[model samples]
Target: MTIPDTGLRTEPGSFRDPTNQVFHLGGDVLRGLDEQAARDYRTLAGTEFFRTLLAAGKVCGTEPVDPLPGVPWTTVLRHERIPFVSHPYEWSFGMLRDAALLHLEILRAALDHGFTLKDGSAYNVQWRGVEPVFIDVGSFEPVREGEPWAGYRQFCQTLLYPLLLQAHLGVDFQPWLRARVDGIEADQLRPLFRGVRRLLPGVPTHVHLHAAMQRRHATASTAAVRDQLRAAGYSRELALATVRGLTRLVERLDHPATESHWADYQRTCGYSAEDRAAKERFVEAALAAGPRPRLALDLGANDGRYARLAARLADQVVAVEQDPGVVDRLYRRLRADREGRVLPLVMDLADPSPGGGWRGVERASFTDRADADVVLALAVVHHLAIGRNVPLPEVVDCLVGLTRPGGRIVAEFVHPDDPMARRLSANKPVGLFPDYRTEVFERLLGARCRIVRRLDLPSGTRTLYLGIVGD
Candidate 1:
């Protein structure tokens, strides 16, 4: 059935699946399903397994909605909005591992019930706080007898290899994921496993053999392979076994963060008891003075201390930290605590995530999604101004830009004489950053925000300013 066109904006990244299309109208996220997809959903949604997952919050909350007037769809469904849309590239190692396991668990359950996911794109998963939720309801389809799992290779590329990259090599996967959305090819990953690493569990089969098969069938017709597999008696039991094995391997994977220094900053940071308390009181006072924020940003959110505080006053908080190790540790804590309001991300503000995919609009840039009701830049200005060589004015401007007009900003300025600031600038030429002073920062900040209040920390080396963004 076709409905009159409405001004719904189609999600640029969702064009791959023609059977289902995602769109946004006002604040609602909508999906249009074709006849086949609608039929599949009707069956899938009725399953006990699906209901259990929904109850456990493993899948996106969905409900049938009145037909939306935009696309030609047999039915429509509305999805609960994710607090902040984060890409796999922005996820910590633990986040990716959790998402991978969630996918395999769903697939295993789906196969048990004579259903399977049609695609294994890691993008199919999103997060509500630390929990991973599968968002592509249309991916569920009746299991085709004799055909192999269609999503195996995609899963390996997008999820497994990236995890293995970090777990085995101690390399961060964020850059690789950001570089190619399709993920690392089996052939590309197979070469990385050398000597003793080649004997790692799940490596020889999932990587080496998978790459060999890719080369052998590079020019073969995919239809012909399905026919051959059918003749060889590829059964649902075999597919289920494969999914179970993958789930085990993913669960066994571990990424022990050993390289990032900032991961333990909270313990080593030279903040006396009085100084720490004073800083907390200042931030709490600032947030309490303003309207409770619907969304808040905690940049350089090491250990998520301030982010946890922000969560008390904000409906949702996006805790962004450049160190993957720090983020991974933070994610583990949140996951254990069942914290569902703060979303921890691994992102370097110096080189934040940018728009990519189809026409560079499928995935949005960091700045594009930075709109927040309040922003906390605590203990962050020095990292950008001195460590990254960002000028004072530009730093303040960027923070102010992230907040909506009349929104609040709680920012801390570290004086050049402070121990942390001195250490950050030690390697630089003498007097290289002459302008990184209290007066310069206050002046620049005042230009963009009306200073609400200012407090000098007990240490006498730091200052906190609460300001309202100007139009």
Candidate 2:
């Protein structure tokens, strides 16, 4: 058998599972499996249900590959590479909900085929733009005769609790998910559902009762408890019913309609038809001036107005915004349109995602993954510089770095006198942001990018700039 030229590099995020390890060789995503996992994979690959899901794009496509001659692995498989790997914390409410539902759907289908997922981790699911696809094929195992769902607690912690936190408590789950990588425990969530909220569907069983059981078995050996349950003949039917119950609960959950300043910014934005049209023309000219990009980054993409335009010039576009509601609304629209090239993520550029998980390399930082050929920083510089207290030079530097050499940057610099900028700088001491000047801004942009075009919008306070990065 032919060996890969480069040494196999294991995917950092996939180290938790001992049965299999993911590796990257050249452009191929390969996974090495132990004997038991290899057996399970062979069985799963032959199943009609697994094949159907793979064909339908609900699961990551996979096929067997030859094991390395010197490797200890019994089998090796290759999986389709996801263009971008995003985490649950970066997902909007709609995106997380869809992922949760997909997990349950896959689990139910697996159960019907006499197999079950060994664990439920939201991280196992990745996105193909607006759609979620399961990527952890090694998670599948043949159902044990009398075993309960092993992934039940993990499902509640990662998927169900996060949804309930948003839908039931009107709390944004992003911060919480980011704070705890493993996810919220039943005890942590149970407190929030107190009083009359205890009566909420699925709370009594999944949250309250689950927490109580955990406390009751606080000192009990896990193996002993699992063995006792198996001895008592925990039926697969019960696990299926539980999965169905959780699915129903998740289906009914929805993020509350909270007012977001930016979600409706397009309508409330003080822009005349002519001005908006002028802005669009300027952006279009910039995008058309360059080679079509493989990837584009639309910073602070409110309502996806410019992201959709970038999609026309780029093979793939990532629309990022700070407000989850805004991203969620945009995601729903894109999903409805079946947009497979534009991925919308909830991110605050001021505190962008960093390399995290084991030694901070398992999950890549935002900058690590973002190497855009076309960058749209329209109407966002002021927000990052003034609103978030980020320095002007830092803001310009970030934009320049995101745009690869020879790439293009479409950015808008809002004057400190602009109404929006004034609002963002409101109540601040005079000279608090001394560097917030139009001259300073241009100098910074010029230092890093070759100014291709500049247009002072009809609104005197706003200026649109198009620059090309030089090698």
The 0-to-1 C-alpha lDDT of every candidate, in the order given, reads 0.90, 0.89
Candidate 1 lDDT over 1-471, as tens digits, reads 122467687887888988998988889998989999999999998999999999998989999999854467899999999888899999999999999999999999999999999899899999888889999988899999988999998899899999999998888999998999788898888878978999998899999989988888888899988998899999899999899889889999998766567977987777889989999999988888878898899999999999999888888999999989889989999989888899999999888889988789888888888888899999999999999999888899899888999899999999989999999988999988989999999999998999989999989999999999987
- Residue pairs clashing in model 2 are none
Q: Across residues 1-471, which tens digit of lDDT does each residue of candidate 2 receive?
A: 223654777787888889998888788999999999999988998999999999999999999987676666899999999877888899998899999999999999999899999989899899888889999999999998678788888888888899888888888899888877788999899889999999887789889999998898899997877888888878889789888888888888888446778878998777778879999999988888868888889999989999999888778899999899889989999999988889999999989998887788878889988888989999999988888889989998999888789989999999989988998889778789999999999999999999989998998889999999988
Q: How close to the true structure is residue 305 of candidate 2, measured as C-alpha lDDT?
A: 94
Give model 1's clash tally.
0
Candidate 1 wrongly placed segments (more than 4 Å): 1-5
Clashes of each: 0, 0
Q: What is the C-alpha local distance difference test score of candidate 2?
A: 0.89
Worst 10 residues of 1 by lDDT: 1-10
